[model samples]
Target: MRTNYEAHDIPYRRKKAAGWPGWNSAEEVHDCIQTLNGLLEPLEVASTADVCEIGCGAGNLTDTLADRGWSVTGVDVSNVAIHWARERCRQQNVTFLRGNICERELFAPASFDLIIDGLCLHCIIGEDRDRVISNLSYWLKPGGRIVVFTMCGEPKGKDRAGYDPKSRCAFSGDIAVRYFAKAEEIIDEFRKESLQCTFQQVVDPPNEQASLRALFEKPR
Candidate 1:
């Protein structure tokens, strides 16, 4: 699938400059960590649970998960991001791979207990989104959880457009990033797929960006 940003340019510059650590502020990172922690609460799973983080930018969330004692596998399309994550994490249990989400062969099915999107899902567009969801569900173990955070909007429709100073471009550029669904929409979609979904809203510190958090479970 074609992405809005110049795959080589900004991703390369951003990767080299500060790696994935520069993607968001320390405060923003803290909020994401807290949000994931909250979602994992009811699961009551061991901290050693196997976790996979898709689009794990600089590995910030992956690092956080590792610190919490989870075995994490972080995947990203950018080679720079993967390299940065591998170098920064340096933990035996944390693995980083560069790959496309549309292809499920990269990782074994039913491999992870928890799969995290961390704002990456918004980047996928059109039929690619459906393929991604299908692959993710297929790869998850029964009763496994998938946690996602993204900009709020209706499910399966056009995304809202605006400039992002960080990326120095309008949302995903020409095509714009797809905002699949809001909290309610996410729940509905999961239900239709026979996956249980729990939704929540997370406001960044001082109420900056409003991100919708959804926790989905594969039926046992």
Candidate 2:
């Protein structure tokens, strides 16, 4: 199955660089990076921590994480995105891998101290959720933390046409599957898989950018 990236990567990358609406927003980019760093602060993420950033578009956030002194590995499904991310985040500690994060083999088992998902999880629903969480579980070292920002409010009706309230899974457009979760639902999704919820907060402002930022930890 092809993803939105496989279909629209070239166009998205161009629009992203051109500062087009819906595709380009420096404020959103800033929000993503700053929020991640803020989350890492509470976790006391050390300089030596091995960090993986999922859907690391253009390295806006990934480069910043590398600057924060961590060894950062940025993963993206788009070869085009990964190309720019590598160039954008040129650093001794930063590396870029082009592949699906849902595939466990993309990374070694128990290899990372932290995983950051900036608007990635919201796009994965149903069985794909299990694939993603399994990869996260496999790659994260014991006691490692995962910080994710996802859609938490009412699903955007236009994009979420076949959303099931009972399951909180939304199928958007032909190939897109999005998920929306309540705060409790967010905690429950991870707790069921032995990942403990450490922190959860709703970001309610900035209009269309409202999201839920949650942190989960793998047991040591």
RMSD per candidate (Å) reads 4.9, 3.0
132-175: candidate 1 lDDT, tens digit per residue: 88888888999898887876543222223454434322345464
The parts of candidate 2 lying over 4 Å away from their true place are 1-5, 8-11, 16-24, 156-173
- Model 2 clash count equals 0
Task: Write down the TM-score of every candidate.
Answer: 0.80, 0.85
RMSD of 1: 4.9
Instruction: Return the lDDT, model 2, position 124.
Output: 69
lDDT of candidate 2 over 1-220, digit per residue (tens): 2245454476557865786432237787777667777877777888889999887767787878888889999888877777777665689999988888777799999999999988877766667777788789889999998998777877653545777677666644555456776756767778877998888898776446458888999999
Index of the highest-TM-score prediction: 2
Name the regions of candidate 1 deviating beyond 4 angstroms.
Answer: 1-9, 15-20, 154-173, 178-180, 202-207
Cα displacement (angstroms), candidate 1, residue 195, comes to: 1.0
Backbone clashes, candidate 1: 2
Each candidate's lDDT (Cα)? 0.71, 0.76
